[model samples]
Target: MSVVARTVGLVTANLLAPAPGGRLDLEGATRAGAGVPLQIGFDEIGVPLSEVTFVVVDLETTGGSPTQCEITEIGAVKVRGGEVLGEFQTLVDPGGPVPPMITVLTGITDAMLVGAPRIGEVLPAFLEFAGFGPTTVLVAHNARFDVGFLRAAASRLEMPWPSPAVVDTVALARRTVTRDEAPNNKLGTLAALFGATTSPDHRALHDARATVDVLHGLLGRLAPLGATHLEDLATLGDPVPHKRRRKATLADSLPTGPGVYQFLGPGGEVLYVGKAVNLRRRVRSYFTAAEKRKRIGEMVDLTQEVRPIPCATELEAAVRELRLIAELDPPYNRRSRKPHRRPWIRLTDEPFPRLSIVRSVPAGRSAEAIGPFSSRAAAQSALEALEEAFTVRRCSQRLPVVPSAEARACALAEMGRCGAPCTGAQSLEDYAEVAASVRAGLTSAAGPVVAALRARIGTLAGQQRYEEAAAERDRLRAYLVAARRTQRLRPLWRSPQLVAARRTEDGGWEVVLVRYGRLAGTSTVPRGVNPMPTIDALVATGEEVPAPSTVLGASGTEEAELIADWIEHPATRLVQHEEGDEPLAWPVDGAAKYPLPPTA
Candidate 1:
């Protein structure tokens, strides 16, 4: 039975549960703020590595898994740009007897734990001591384990959780070290290899300090790789070199929920994406596979990483999957069949600027742009067509203006294509009106273009210009095809998603993942057995497929940026669409979404 299932019965009727022991102390020393962590060495993300705060945390718990365990000890040390500022260590009295095995493992005895303040009494003070300011970030080793406990303890006490963001040093090691660097991830093993320093004892504070040292060592190595934020360090770990994960063991105790999962190769390439309502049960399914070697050869050969995000509901999980797929464009996911690839019609910024074909200009920085086409060739053809039909300039180089009297107001002016500015045939208002029409033509699709073409066709037929009218008809069809082939409107998972995976009892496993869409806070899912959609979908929106730059060398950097954006989306204060029952949405401004895939 899950430890969490057993502890549910421990809550008291009063909102406040009893303190674990008599009040530990009337705490006084002013606590520092928890600041956000940054890849201090890299400058692109703009978060100063020095100014950002890092809290190294370790928790002693009664058992494994926060859902099943109770926290007995919490230790932390705050550091800024590698400088230790202050620290917090406290003991929480677990109301139950300490299990013998746990006592031996942690050396935290019942005697040492007794008479200590319960998590409820000691938490607020510790949170205050952690010193969270607008941007403090936490650091831990295997952070999710500690983070989960902190979350649970805070929920039980009804106190505001002090820190929401964290950095894991283990993840840093995985990113920076060679795949063959270490066979094991035990703290002492990594510290010894990396020349990281920590107290000899395995106490909470010492462990936290060790993690910090190890993280510093990792940063010292990866800074040259150009990591400017913790996200870079956290995600840049080298993928496992071998295929397929080690078989799930009986030791793993899984949780049931909705989430997305990924299989990565040792080189850190995403091999596959899956989801499950119940994390443990879903993941277990893979382990029990009779044809595991054949059915999952790609996964086994390619996978070095496993990532999961938990969701409150199945729908949210699916949504998150779609978002990730869209954003990350993981090579394994479905490829977009858009007719044009970032094919856009650009209105040039220079004088005598005319409509032209271009592939992708920056977003929110347009020179009067419209439509992302299915192919660059399509955009080029469209531009050619428009240039012929309207004598808009096509050359990128500046052209000498002809004397208006001799040129007879150019072809467009004669046909009313423009306001004849060269010949001074119209007022500024007329010129403005013509400019608006040009923009409309660029953005308008087949239906409207056809309607305009039809009228023009009649006018041309009267003038006995049937050839021009027929050409106009063809242009209308092209626009319609482009629009139908490329325009995609789907729901957005604007919020950060959390995916949790653990070992399953059945040999195969399931995972529980959460999707906090852009607007809703969080929704908890019912325990059920089912596979989730895909992450490519959740990360699919508003992304540009990447190209290799001499600087970036093209191994999913574009995709990495997209994933990072999804992970680090700023807080969503208002829902674009209204919905109710969001579990954790209350700030006047939205809370920053988490971007780190692992809870390091």
Candidate 2:
């Protein structure tokens, strides 16, 4: 027999006999504010069933609908470890006479409630007796009806309702008790099956007593099926598949720390990579009903082993997870798969520089690179926007310092779209001036380019070329987005190195070192300890980063942007910064000031 069954069987076996130590308390208790319900944290392993206090409650109401009905009486029994601790029972005034149908069903007459206290007076006492909070679990048969009435009463009375964790014995009985064991999950049927001392009637106190016994019986049946914790009981209805749950042992070896975890398939291939604030708890959650994602379930079923990489802080774990996903290209990781492969638009180093889409920027010409746009399509749109505003040549051929007289001009030159430098129609000096304007539009100042695009959109709209005007608007928006991002990241790339720190919740310190926008090192200082020595040591031992060759700095734009965001977080404090010739600061109202073409 299960432990709960063995302990509580005697109480149920003797039907109609009062349980030992089951005493009803008529006096009311008082507690402070209606406390918030406690949520089960990711790091919480389990709350043992034996340690949980359950308050089996039942309410007598004037009508079936909570909105129309009023609570007439409150009855509750607090029990722990198959033993009743106390009971609360009281008739409430309900502010009106009992309905004829309610009186016929419950035998509660208006005369019987002559001088009863109101719900406002009775609810606070009942909540206090129930010990409302994490340690207590409220239980009832057809719990929705009873809890709904109580919630409605509280709402009507303008009283705070502490939303305690609730367990519906009806739901539990359906999951645990066989049809042969009980004809139905009703309070009376369950109470009779369990041989409860008190029989359930329409009255509040009797039904609450019966539900306490029923709750114990259901818990006993669930115990053998491994429902030994409050967390397990909460998910009893939607139990995890046994096959998947058997693999929960994989997390047994993982430490309770912030880190990255990889689920490996049979062939040692990484199936999924994820970061967690608590490695063990988060990994174990995959085997519980809490993890409801279908793709994740498939990945879990295929997982043969769990690999943990512990980190000192959440940010470090996040960075490591991103890097691992990029490196391994895990099949189950949908994000950061190609973190370093984002595209950038670059102006070539020829005598006549023309915009070209390139993944990596050329050395010493970081100023000529415009973006790390989300996709090639977005970069193309931005490129087209700049092309529309400038007279630079659009041809792909390499133009000489002096163009040959035999060189043929493309149709773009005939359409007046290009300067036609290849045909010597436009001189190098003239093209140079245009290239400088394009370069200026790409960086430092984008107002002229934005104005040109807006003007083109307005002219197109005036001509009733609305489709073309809408296309111009899209291109202008894409260009402004990329320009804003580039302007935001440029200052971080220009800085030689930066040291910053943020105070952790535990009163410790998380210090980070960045060299040219790349996270070079990180360390933590325990609470009450001097952080200066640790910060100095971290800075000295940090990786040496050479001067960045492109606008992307010493790392991919994504990584640089991540580091820059971390430095700008409100909690972060700058300690030291080695600025280049120019001060490391973003332009005041730079590309952000440029307006996009209006939709209409």
Per-residue lDDT of candidate 1, residues 1-600 (tens digit): 111101012211111111000100011101112323322221112234556666678878888866567888777877765567776777778888779998888888988876787777777776777776544666677766677677777767776665444566666666567758777767887787766656525578778767777767766675445343333333344332212223332103334557877766677777666666656445533432212345365454454456677775554465566656666667666545221245667666544556766655443223145445556665664554454445353335543343245534556565655555555565545545545555545533223344455576678888988677665545544444433222211011212343333323343323322232221223222244332333223233313323222111121122223323333344212222322122223222111111111111
The true-versus-predicted C-alpha distance at residue 73 of model 2, in Å, is: 2.2
Please give the lDDT score at residue 332 for candidate 2: 86
- Tens digits of per-residue lDDT for model 2 on 1-600? 000101122233111111111111111111123323334444334334565677888999988887887888888877776667777888888788899999998999998888888887787788778777555777888877887788877888888877766777887788877889878878888889988889988898789888888877777775555444455555555647767765766776788789999999999999999999888767877876668899999999999999999998777787788788888999988875664467887788899989998887754666677788889998999999899989878888889988887899899898998978997888889999998988877777787778878899899999999899999998998888888877777777778888999999899999998887778889999999999999899988999999976667776666776787788899999999988644666555457786654654
TM-score of each prediction: 0.37, 0.83
Q: Which ten residues in a row have the lowest lDDT in candidate 2?
A: 17-26
Highest lDDT: which candidate? 2
